[model samples]
Target: MAYPRKPLFAPNGAVATSQPLAAAAGLAVLRRGGNAVDAALATAVALTVLQPPSNDIGGDLFAIVWDGERLHGLTAAGRSPAALTREMVLAATGRRAAEPVAALGGAQARGPAMPARGWLPVTVPGAPAGWHDLHDRFGSLPFADLFTDAIGYAEHGHPVSTGTAIGWARAVAGHAGLVGAEFAEFERVFTVGGRAPRPGERWRNPDAARTLRRIAETGADDFYRGRIAEALDAHAARTGGLISGDDLARHTSTWVDPVSARYRGHEVWELPPPGQGIAALLALNILDGWDPAGADPVERLHRQVEAVKLGFADAHAHVADPERAPVPTAALLDPAYAAARRALLTERAGDPVAGDPERGGTVYLCTADAGGMMVSLIQSTYLAFGSHVVLPGHGFALQNRGTGFRLDPDHPNVVGPAKRPFHTIIPGFLTRDGAPVGPFGVMGGHMQPQGHVQLLAGMLDAGLDPQAALDAPRWYWHAGRTLLVEPELAARPGLVAGLRARGHEVAVAAEPSVFGYGQALWRGAAGWVGGSESRIDGAAVGY
Candidate 1:
């Protein structure tokens, strides 16, 4: 199993992404003397152009980068607008107290707890500012150079990949036309003739190109405090939304230290609070107590599922913006907490109670340069097309990330001025003995951290190579007892029966794509090995 099934090996540099164009764009940058950071930035921007349904200029961004000596984590998630509040949403929706996520299906004689796709949940976008912060820190190429390929694709056109086309169609059906008249712009721009583009269809966005060109020329400041911000403010004002010019001007991405846990001999790292990355660390810490190699596949899945629940319970209670509600990243990831939670796991799924912690559509890419620099970056528009309130004339949508904030004022992640919500997307990294091992990540709404735990276990415990680790069938646990198993995995004779016997209410995923799409790069003696999830239109490329 350790043998790579479809590993792509490279020597000087390597880049992997969920889209071939994005991967190639990054690799081309590296080939042209760009470092890993430059390549990662290129790929991230290209992803926004190539996969609009999953990631776009509208979303948040997070990254874990290893620069030979140290690992740096970035929090690029946007905060609640100064003018926005939970009460504002309640008022706009005509409710005393807005509904919660649990009452998502049209509350009993009540409007939905929160607006899933509208300006009510629009937060200030941070990806543009995030790109500038990253480039300012580690880029070797001109900031504008990083977006060249992405701009070309946006202005001209590119053939849609099978997966992206499928996802785009779903977004059209799910996010567009469902809101109100304001979302009409989304239907106009995202769809072709009022329908999602079919696979192989050529799509272009000159508006997005113009926006990128502006950012390229003036840096991301144009997005945060300049023209784009003005447009956002005007749109918000016209649409009765919350974002203000002040909100955009005050936005800045935070640079933080990476939080990590040791699994076996290697260290697994993730971005700290406000993101669900801790879920991966917590699960790994809990799994560290047992001998994974000795456990059967069912046992491994069961253990990870249980540990994730505990992590979520704590994260929901504790994880929030460091400025608004500082999370004790060190204390939360302490060995003692994980060990105590580990002790609660038994033979079957347990209704694990939280010790009272705390905490999308997404694109994850990784790049490794010959100079020993590696970056694991992720970005997302939250729910497909994000808010569905496309900014007319600007060619980009705004993120519904604010929907993540709890309606409860007592909650740590409750909506507040300039507070980052409980973010779902996280980029992951690995190292051994203080040396960089590589960069890795999975992207799929809440399935991100879940995928991280599964992928890390597959490689660390089962001795699977990067590709085999990614290729392994996936299982996701949710809402307590329900376990969604991939059909490929459900077909495994005893797997379903075994899970059901252990108290899991098993259901095979009708569309396995939601499990997640991942990209990974492993650095070792030979050079570099990269893996892209088999379920996407992705590739691992290098020069």
Candidate 2:
């Protein structure tokens, strides 16, 4: 189904998000004389309450901000518990940390990485700090003022939108049988009457309201060093969790430099390491080598898919916590190296190996204020309902970001104490000629970078508008030689067959959610132009 173009244009401010209410929350902040950072912070906080299945107060955050003069990057991701170690995890799970499993013929390799859910994978959350720090740096409104809408929604309840309802049901189904104590709090807080809420159903979480209020009033200190930390400590003690008060106190959101790749005269910017954003940059680097302007439709997609494969292969091999491991970000994005990597691409789908130069959730929301400040932000709990270990009486779950750590001792991403993991959620921005274009991002685990490439290609390469860029069908590169495309993209004339002829495996996606939900804001002559996801219950509001 082709979505019709109905872009929102506003003279003063614009906000876009995966949930409509969240978008409205940001817009309201802007109307209240807040800057772009404040509006984005409001939207992000509102998403925690409105889209619990995707994000929460327990999640991590990353953002790229254009604060009139230049761009700024924020990495609010948390680290592994200070007490956690590979040996401890192995012992807890009945595996030998120093020995290899019998199935693999290695003498000294560990077993698989940590499980997807439970206390072992829970990391100290950085979102509260993220909110406070972003505001401290670039925000105009009072920090407490930003929480008004989120607290109201949590206390008084709001109708569940279709997208949130669908994700909520799926998360409930996924965790149906794990009746352990670690998951009990999640079940209690999220499920009402032993089931997920239906669309348009009013759902309330007064506990979350109380928590947000405290965080706001206390400037988020309680979450890291005070009452909320005490509660988290007690809960961890009762549930055999590893996070402690010290771990919570040690967590901080960092202000880092943003990285960029030049694509067709425009520079696409993303947050630096500890994120897979570099993958999007690498893929764009490869795509830049080709004149996609006059390329065949099928051929254009083929190159795009192949480029992403190469990008992911290298990113998986080398993109880790740079503070813990060496990541060759500069060498990888070098034009000469990108050209060398591009040399591997052919008419057929080929599995490209990682080059030596190497390396490089998850709400995505963007806001633009009349002051010319633009912000691109993304926050997530890693997976749905995160570790399934909700803070008792808090009505929020902890993120399972520890699962991103590889178990192998020789790997760059090996699990260890006080180290950040390879993160999936990233925020993106675009600019040309040293001036800001606007903020943009796509929210879905691995589909994020892929969506970035496709979005930019549609706009910069194909001359499509923001709405058309988002409304276009998407394709996800699943694995080696395999591609999962939307039904609409598959239905394109000769597209699937053409891809198959090039030694690619093409399957129409079983669900549309895998393609991701995206948001974008572009500066127009009259004001800011915004586009939101058509596949999800999202909106791009302007005022």
Candidate 3:
């Protein structure tokens, strides 16, 4: 069922994103003499308008930027509202106490848990600040110009894509029973005639356009300290929400050095703690001990899944905000630690346990410019439609990132005031011998790093082209020893049987989105080559 597609080549620039329009928006910026950072910021803003179910202006953002000479990492994830506390959250959920994932053997939390969508799970959105900071550091074009396409689409309307339509319906269905006043604005802003828009239907949001204009004009100050913050505070006071103007004003995105692990002959890079980018690095570290270059398909997959399980186990155990608690980043990425973890991966899939390292959603996009600058960026609202708490006048939803917090009091990521919770969205980049290769990323909740591991193996080890690597059948280690594979992968001549023989609870998934969608850009001798995700409506446009 593979489609005939080749990587697009461009001498000057390239942009890839989940939506065709978003990619085009970035390309337009490149054509306007904007650098890769400008193109990336343009695309990121447009996605908030074009793909509302996946991301919005009211979300978290992380990025790895190659500004020609070196790499820069930005983590714009927001902290919990100062008004919120662990005691209040526990009381709200009616849970006397909570159990850690270690106690549950990495099973999805059962019993009382944080609400998936509500004012309770909402946190300070850091994307607006992220956009501002990235531009201040790397942009070559006027900041206001980046919002032109996004604002135009928001005001004039654009046809919804198939994948977005499906997600829109699912989100509406998921929140159908929420009739609270806090949820009313969401229904009004996102729906037409009380329902999600169908594919190709024109969707407009004048309010969102206005808000984007304010951010563009004020350089995002409006979002954190001006009118937008006042409006959000007023809404929170009226509703039973926790966020306040102080929380918004105090939010600041951090710039950190990118963490990396050498894989094959290249170095894979991601942002550090509090975000799960380390999980991909951890998995890669363990995987580096053995060369799966020409191994059997089953054996390669088994090792990949096993490494991922161990990575997630440790990530879930230790990854928390370093500002709040200690995160042994160096210890976790140590070569010796990886060797010790690799030894545990036997012929059989064993229950993964924490080895004292650490842990760590959303949309992913990559843009490359003729100047050799590349940007890998990811942003998200946590879940489909986020907390489903759209701002009344602004017409955007806030992220439910607080849900990533553990309810266990002893956990490093426990819910607390002004502390960032665990983040799922991560952007990745590749380099060899200190030279830039390209920027790449996958977008899904926990499937992000898993996608990173699988995608890299295909491109680097098997020598598949970027498109082929993305098109290849995928697998996800859901929880425990259970493994979810696409129907195509299951049909791969005894692939399922082989995995099951290794004590894996193999389940063939019906939906392809469960494996996530990704985009990649590779720097070749000829030019910049790019690949776009085929599982959804997307494009890789260059010139």
User: Candidate 1, after superposition: displacement of residue 280 in Å?
Assistant: 1.0
How many residue-pair clashes does candidate 3 contain? 5
Error of 1 at 362 (Å): 0.4
Backbone clash count for every predicted candidate, in the order shown: 10, 0, 5
> Across residues 1-543, which tens digit of lDDT does each residue of candidate 2 receive?
543868888999999999989999999999989999999999999999999988999999999989899999999999999999989888978888776632111122234767778988888898999999999999898999999999999999999999889888988997887767778877778988879999999999999999999999999999999999999998889878999999999998889999999999999999888898999999999999888767788999999999987787767677788888998999989999899989989999985542211001458899999999999999999888888889989989999988877777777777899999888888999999889999999888778888999999999988887888999999987556778899888888999999999999889985878888899999999999999999888899988
RMSD of 3: 2.5
Residue 241, model 3, lDDT: 93
State each model's CA lDDT, in order: 0.83, 0.87, 0.88
Q: Model 1, range 191-293, lDDT digits (tens) per residue? A: 8888999999999999999999999898888888788889988988887778889999988899999889989899999988888888788888888888876
Give me the displacement of residue 319 in model 3, in angstroms. Answer: 0.6
TM-scores for the candidates: 0.94, 0.96, 0.96
Name the lDDT value of residue 441 in candidate 1: 90
Model 3, 29-128: lDDT tens digits are 9999999999999999999999998999899999999999999999999999998887898778775544342221144342244677889989999999
Error of 3 at 259 (Å): 0.6
C-alpha lDDT of candidate 1 relative to the true structure: 0.83
Better of 1 and 2 by lDDT: 2
Supply candidate 3's per-residue lDDT for 333: 96
Ranked candidates, highest lDDT first:
3, 2, 1
RMSD of 2: 3.2
